[model samples]
Target: MSIPLDIAALGERAAAMIEELGAISQSPDTLTRFFLTPEHRRAADLVGRWMREAGLDVTEDALGTVRGHWHPAGEEAPRLLIGSHIDTVAEAGKYDGCMGVILAILALEAVTRVGLSRPYGIDVLAFGDEEGTRFPTTLSASAAVAGIFSPANLTMRDADGISYRDALIAYGKNPDDIPAAAYDPDKVIAYVEAHIEQGPVLEAENEPLGVVTAIAGASRLSVTVTGEAGHAGTVPMRMRHDALLGAAEMALAVERIAKADRHGMVATVGRMHIDPGSVNVIPSRVVFTVDLRSGSDTSRRDALTRFEREAHRIAAQRQLSVVISAFHEVATVPCYPDLQLRLRRSITDVDRRAVAMPSGAGHDGQAMSKLCPIGMLFVRCRGGISHNPAEFAAPLDMGLAAAALVRFIERFNLPHLENNTTGAET
Candidate 1:
C-alpha cells in the first residue's frame, strides 16, 4: 500500500523545525553557526533526535555529515539520496539551507506512513559546513564525500588563524579520519536538494517554485592599482597620481562589460581598500576584489578577459600600475538533464507551467554533482533576500515546494548499472 502525501502535515513540520532553529542565537546576527561550533553541534544533535523520532537509522559521519536512512520493508531495494546543508552564513535567514533538510525529514515520514517501500532505499543528509562561515573553503563536507577535498584543506585556517584540523580536534572529531567520509559513487543512485530562491527571478515572475537547470560558475580577481601619492592640498588634480581615481575608472569598466553581456552575466566589486585612507591625503594604492559569474564557462571567461583588458587600458590612461591576481575559480556545473526532467515532471504534475531557471548561488548540490547525478528545487523567497535576518518565504510557497518534492521522490527511478547491490540482502 502506497502512503498518501499529506501537504499540510509536511508544511507544519517544516515550519516548526525552522522556528526551533531560528530561536538559537549563534552569532551577533544569530546566523553565524559555523561547523565545529557549539551551536552548530547542538543543531546537529537536534536533527539527529528528529531523525530517530522519524524511525530512521541515524549516524554522523567522521566529517560531521548526519545521515538518516529509511530502509524499505520488502525486497529489491533502491537507494535515493536527498539532502542539503544546515549551516548558515553570518546573519543568515532560517530558510536558506535548513529548509531542504526539514523537507527531507517530512518526505520520509510520509513515505513510511504509506507503508510503501521503494524499489530502493532512501537516505536524508544534513550536510555540515556548506556555507564555509568559519573558513574560506565552502562545501567542505560535501567535497569530502565527492573525493574532491584534499589533505591540504585540513590545515586551512580561519580569519583568526585557527586550523580546520585543530577545530575538528576541539570538537571531539578526528581530522585523520576525514577519509572515512568519502562515498563510493556506485552506491548513490541520485542526489536531490531543495533550497530557497535567493534571487528575484522566481518572485519577479510571480512563480512559487523553480526547477534548476544549471549552477553558475564563479571567478574572483584581486586587483591593485599603484600610483605615487602626494599631498592633497599641494598637488593639483591633473599633476596628481591618484590610484583611487584609476581604480574607480576600472570599477566602472567592469560594470560596462557586465551590462554588455546581460545574458545571465554579473560582476561585483564587493571588497575594496585604500591605503593611507585619511582626511587631506591622496591614496597611493587601491586594492579591490571583483566577483564574476555566468551560467556558461565561455561567457564567464569572456567577461573576465574583457574586464582585465579594460582595467589595463584605464590604468595606462591614468598613469597607474595595475596588477591582477587570481583569487578563486569555480567552473559552472550543469545538473543532470535526465534528473532535471524528472523534477520538471514532478513540478508539472502539481503546476503545469513550471519554469526552468539557473541557480546563481553556489550550493552543496554543485559539489555533490561531481560524484553522482544531482538535481535541485527552489522555493520563492520574499523579496529574494538571503544571507540576512529578514530573508523569508511564504508558508503557502513552502507547502507547495514540499508537495513537489514528495511527488518527485515517488516518481524517480534508480539505475541498476552497478553490481555493488547484487549481493546485498533486500
Candidate 2:
C-alpha cells in the first residue's frame, strides 16, 4: 500500500500537459475553445489519449464529455467521480478549467502505477460546455450526466445562428443519444472537483489549497423608481422629488446591508439608467439592478426581504413610487460534510492547512449535485484572477493539489459514502 509521491514531478507533468492542451485553441495567439468546435474535438482527443496512457478505459458521451474510467472493483461498481470542464472563455488562461482535468489524469496515472485496489471505481470526466461561450446554454454536458438536462436546450442557438442540436450533428453526435448519458443515481458515490480559487481569498490567506463549503447562490433584482419631472435649475432642492437620488440611496442600502451581514454576502449595483439624463432636468425615473450572492440560502432570502423593505422606505421618504422584481435566482449547493472532511484530511496529510471557503463563481458541480453529494478543492491562483489570459497558478501549488488528490484516492473506501445523502450539508 506504500505509494511514493513525487510532488515536483506531478506538478511538472501538470504544467506540460496544460500547455499541450492549451495549444489547441481556435485562435493561435490566444485561447478560445468553444463547445463542439474543431478545437474542442482536438482537446477531447488529447485527453482521451492521455486517459489511455494512464491505463483507463476512455469513452465519450453523446454531449462530447470525455470519460476516463478506472474500475478496480468491476465495471458495475459504484464510482468516485473526479473531473472538471475543458472548455475555456475567450482569451482564457491556461489553468482555469484545464488544470483540474490534468491533475485528475496525473493522480490516476500514479494510482494505476501502484495497482491500487478498492471496492469502487473512478471516472475522470472532461466536460466541454462549462464555459458556454459558444451556445446560449451552459452546463449542458454535465446536466446530461446528472439526468437534469432539458430537451429545450437543444434549440438554443449560438452567435452564428447555429442551433445546439445542429452543432452536435456537425460534431458527429446524435441528439437522441443524449438520454443515455445519465448515470444511474444508485451507482454513484459522489462527485469531486479540483479547481483554481478564481478569487483572492486563498491567495490572501497564503494557502496552497482550500476545501469548498458551498457554491454561493445568487439573486438578481431590478428596482425601478418613478417621480414627477422637474427643472433642475428652478426647482428647490427641498421640494423636488428626484427618482435618481432615491435610487442612489437604495444602492447604498444594498451595500450597507451586505457589509453589515455576517454570512459573507456580496451585493452589486452593476447597472443603472436614468430617464432624461440631462444637467438641467431632474430625473423622473431611474432603474437599477442588484446582484446578491451568498453561501446560505436562508441568509440570502432574508437579505432580499430587508432590501425590499429598505427600498420602499427610501422611495416613500422621497415621495417617489418604487417597484422591485426578481429576474434570476439559484439556490446554494453545499458540499457533503463527509467529503469535505476527507478532502481536508488529504490536504493536511500533505502538510498544508486546508481553508474552508465557498465558491463565489459557478461551476459544473452545481449541475452535478443533482446526481450525488459534491465537493470541491481549490488551488490558489495569482491575484485570484480568472476568465482572463493573466490568470496563473504556481506549478508547486498545482503539484501539491495533484498529490492531495492522490492521497484522497488512496484513503477512499466505499462505506464512507454509502450512508451519505445528497444536498445534506445545507
Clashing pairs in 2: none
Which digits, one per residue and each the tens of the lDDT, describe model 2 over residues 180-224? 999998899999999999999988999999999999899999999
Model 2's alpha-carbon lDDT is 0.92
Instruction: Find the 10 residues in a row with the least total lDDT in model 1.
Output: 417-426
**Model 1 stretches with alpha carbons more than 4 Å out:** 1-3, 27-29, 73-78, 157-162, 231-240, 415-426
lDDT for each candidate structure: 0.81, 0.92
Candidate 2's TM-score: 0.96
Point to the candidate with the largest lDDT. 2
TM-score per candidate, chains pooled: 0.90, 0.96
Q: Against the true structure, whose TM-score is highest?
A: 2
Report the C-alpha displacement of residue 302, candidate 1, in angstroms. Answer: 0.8
